[model samples]
Target: MKKLLLIVTNIDMYASGKLRTGLWLSELTHIYHSVKEKGWNITIASPKGGAVPIDPESLKPLVLDKISKEYYENPVFMDELNHSKSLEEVKNDSFDCIYLAGGHGTMYDFPDDTNLQYIISKQYESNKMVAAICHVVGGLLNAKLSNGEYLIKGKSMTGFNWFEETIARRKKEVPFNLEAAIKERGADYSKSFIPMTSYVVADKNFITGQNPFSSKEMAKIVIRELEKV
Candidate 1:
């Protein structure tokens, strides 16, 4: 069985503290169920660990999907969120892949976690896969290869684009523009011409999805890459 490390944001609010923000529920649930169905073992971890907040907006009827709704209602699954391991606890564990699940909160915490940067660099340098979706791709922004070069430099990838952020009406709320940041790191970023549509990119050991809607397809890509190994 394959092992997956899923990293989520521990942040419950944006920098402003007025808007509630946290893990985008579907980004975790969509990929979790996709891989779990294959009987893969998964461990959820966060920068600070403990209970991870779910963006309240994500649970709203119009935004919540059936799969996410099911998991949100499952006590067992909710327990996993409530007791997520800290990155410090799993720094030495080996996993076939490390997946970063996105939410607006990721913009604040994902970019600066030293543990996350090391884990991503180590995983990629080992030739294992590192995957991320939506805003959590911000986590990759600061991860550097052992050579001191950025991990994303020159990689073809996609994340939650600025357009989507604007469409979501969070352009001003997010600390930085995610699409621009990815490009600044020299990643060849791209997104769906139609906002919120599924768009995924696979480049060598890295796989990225454009937005929440892209998680399932991104998981399919991750499973395929693992099989190739």
Candidate 2:
């Protein structure tokens, strides 16, 4: 069976030191179910590994959907989250794709993680699919190809937009402007005209989503790419 490596943030609080944050549960469950339905195997991992944190805001009823609710109630899935593998535990080339799930916490850990960057760069270099959604795209900002060029350079991609931060009232809490950071790295960033709408961009093996709303769509795109291989 094809395997997918799903990366989630280990950080549980925003840089502001007051606002709580962690992995957006929906972003992981939505894509995870979509891929699993296609008979694909998935391995969840995090920067630090044990007891993944779920953002409190993500558990609110306003944001909870059927898929996420199901995951929330499933003990087996919750157990998987509690025992996620650490980056060091993952074997190179063991996965067919690498997907980074987004949340406010990703901004704290993803970009500067040398091991994470190395894994992503290696996957891309091997012609495997590399995808991320929302703030998780932060991980790609510093990833370097074997040629030493930034992985996102000259690639068209999309992630959490600056405007969304403003709308979500989290502009001050987030560490940096994710959209601007990727643009500065030479990504041809694009997004929905309206904030919080589902928008996904596929550039070869690189698939990116604008926000949590785009998670399932992003997974579909990834599945399509996997089918072609």
The residue-level lDDT of candidate 2 at 228 comes to: 92
lDDT of 1 by residue, 12-107 (tens): 998877899999999999879988898999999999999999999889999898999999999999998989999999988999999999999999
Off by over 4 Å in 2: 91-93
Candidate 2 structure quality by residue, lDDT tens digits, 1-229: 7899999988998877898899999999988998889988999999888888899989999998999999999999999998999898894647889999999999998999988998999899889899999999999999998888999999999999999999889998888999899999998989999899999999999999999899779878888889899
Q: What lDDT would each prediction earn against the true structure?
A: 0.92, 0.91
Please, what is the TM-score per model? Answer: 0.98, 0.98
- For model 1, state the Cα shift of residue 86 in Å: 0.2
TM-score of 2: 0.98
lDDT for model 2 comes to: 0.91
Model 2 pairs whose backbones collide: none
65: Cα error in model 2, Å: 0.5
Range of the 10 consecutive residues with the lowest summed lDDT in candidate 2: 86-95
